[model samples]
Target chain A: MARFGMVIDTKKCVGCQDCVIACKTENKVPEGHDRDWIVTESHGKFPDILMEIRTERCNHCSNTPCVSCCPTGASHIHDVGGVVLVNHDLCIGCKACVESCPYDARFIHPDGYADKCTFCIHRVEKGLKPACVEVCPTYCMHFGDLDDPNSEVSKLLQSRKYHVNLPEAGTQPNIFYLI
Target chain B: MHEIFTTRNNPYVDPIMAMWEWQIPVYLFLGGMVAGMMIIAGYFLFSGRHKESNCACFSIPFTSLILLSLGMFALFLDLAHKPYVWRLYTTFQLKSPMSWGAWILILVYPALIANILIRPSQWMINRVPKLSEIAGKIQQHHILIRNIGILNMLFGLMLGAYTGVLLSTLGSRPLWNTSLLWVLFLVSGLSAAAAYVHLVAKNKAESELLAKADNGFLVVELFVFVMMFLGLLSSAKPHIEAANLLLNGAYAPIFWVFVIGMGIVIPLIIQLLAVNHKVKHTPIAPIMVIVGGLILRFVIVSAGQYSHWFNAHFH
Candidate 1:
């Protein structure tokens, strides 16, 4: 019943995209489609400009519109850590989940079914970190159970100032960025 | 006074890309039109108009059944996993609008089929002699026929509203996230159906009556649309921006020129004149309404796609 979550440090992230490449290879995401990517944001004038580089993927929301909108229950929350996953066989490729995702996380796979980051549930179940988290060269990404107060993610969230993307969206996104 | 620049190059989700193409709009249009046909046919049947040789109910329901099947085919084509399309009927998710839509669509068949049984076609009766007996038996049972009419109208209303409610359920798309969308689509479908019935119904009195009804539906549809625009405009920044897509943004020209002008205003004027007996009823007006309904679907769906929830971090 653990609620798994990810915490990324915005200041430390260099946007190297090693995590993106690692995820594509680990998940075997089709060529031209990506399960994870990076975003670089900058603001302010000339000499006082500021930039924050962040890697992004599915937020694995607690209140997921993707699962709620899925007609066939093809998209679901995992029993173990509440990771969002898609049942490829049950999917009708309707794209209802794709359109409903506020994160713009879900996409229709080239082969048909809606696909997106699963938090590497397969790996998470095997007692390992998600491929993206494991391959972060800067050691900027952290993953652990959000429900467990003793977990690394919980500790970091408690001790650091952080923000979740699109808080107004009300998805209750699990991904947190330490500002 | 801070400036920010954040971007991603994902071709699918970024840059206001819509995963759905022409198939979705076409399906909605056909679905909405069929919905309109069924309700009109249902009302006529309830009024016991089938006894008259020139009544539209006897023919329109039959035609709507086929068109509903066509619309389902369009829906099937839009599915990414076509082979697994049957999964929709496997287990229904109560919270899902798509699930509700799937069940509503399936139930529509029985309503349409029972309406057909109220008066079986000659060829059908000829092919299966028992069909004549069955039709006759069903016709004599006034209660069952009326119930069938009620079912047709019920399903028709569900089908019509579901088309827009489906999109409205997607809160991510601000343009479609409105309480008024279902009403707008339902009225538009009704108007389109009335226009079509007006165009083809041989019953002169009924056709003229429907022509007037179409005008009323068109005005109500215009009102619903304005309410939807005002609803979006009065909301958050993203929603206001979403409304602008059809108001002043890239989607404006087609929405105003085609959907509002040619689709509603022009057709309503023509139908008004025709109903008043000022001008002979031309096929042009009805056709415009039908085409306008189709374009309305296209515009709402396409414009809604361009309106996504703003990603604060992604810009």
Candidate 2:
């Protein structure tokens, strides 16, 4: 019942992309592939400008369209903590899951399978944080079990005004950005 | 609100390069054509149109088997893990369109075989004496032949609709997310198949009947297409942009000239003329329909990928 999630404080993010490099290194995601990235938005005119920087990745939704669309069940949810992962051995590389994903989070790995952010389940299993969360210098990223009321991610959701990427998509994304 | 969101151009994550290429569109076109053929053949068999049924049954099964194999091969080439392709057969997922499509395609083969058995060719009976006996047994049981025809029609309908459902299930691509997509694909497939059969049928009556049928399908296809565009235009901003991509954007030339003009309009006019005895039947219109069908798949697949949420959100 433990739903793992992330809370990113956009106000604190610097758009440095260190988290991106960390994810690539940790996941060995290949030269031209990524597990996470940053999106920057600029609002208002030059005299009155508001620049917003936020890092993004797979939302790991409660209702994952990728999992629903995958023919081979290669894209599945990890039972332990509700983490979404792809079994490359079972993936036919049809790219159905890749297309179904509203976040554009999933990618076809060069070795031939659907690949996406795993929320570093490999590290989380070892009682450690994801590479992106660990490497973010500004500490803008927070990851924990959202189901646990005591967890930092849950507390952040209670304390902050946050918005998900695409509410209309109906995926119920776990990644929240603090306004 | 003048707000600008910029997504960094990262080919690594953006899916800017289409994962599906020429192979997918080719597979879709062939699959749709086969499905359309089966439905037409099945209808002829059930209606007791012996000459028409013979013409259709002669070519449908064998051609479908060959085309299905080629289409599967094309799909295999597109797989990153080609060796693991058998995993698609291991289990069934009700939620997955690809899973449904895989199962439907498997069922199509058996239905096609049954159809072939119901009416074996002279060459086939001559080559395999045992097949003649099987064909005789199958032909005697009118109920069995009727059942096969029904199965073929059902599977054909499923196959045709599934092609569009496959793309429409992709929620991220606004262009492919329409409810009308499956209907459009089904009508287009029927139209293409009718045109194809009209070209190949030896009997003038059958050929003319199919041409008339093709005209009906073409009209419905045009209407469904317009509905799809209008539906998308009325939805969210991203969906509107996706529609605009076909209406007047980068894909406008292909959408307007090829899919609408050459594919639907020109073929409709030609078929209408042929139906009215205004002009002699020519292969040009049927050939145009098939080509137009193929191009439609390619453009839809390509343009759907191009109509991404991030692209619309950022730009």
Best by lDDT: 1
Question: Which lDDT value does model 2 have at A170?
Answer: 87
* Candidate 2 overall lDDT versus native: 0.86
Best by TM-score: 1
Q: Write down the C-alpha DockQ for each prediction.
A: 0.65, 0.59
Give the winner by DockQ: 1
Encode model 2's per-residue lDDT on B234-267: one tens digit a residue: 9988899999999999999999999999998998
CA lDDT of B179 in candidate 2?
A: 88
Stretches of candidate 1 off by over 4 Å are B1-11
Interface RMSD of 2: 3.2
Candidate 2 chain B: worst 10 consecutive residues by lDDT? Answer: B4-13
Model 2, residue B176: displacement in angstroms? 1.0
Q: What would the TM-score be for candidate 1 when compared with the true structure?
A: 0.97
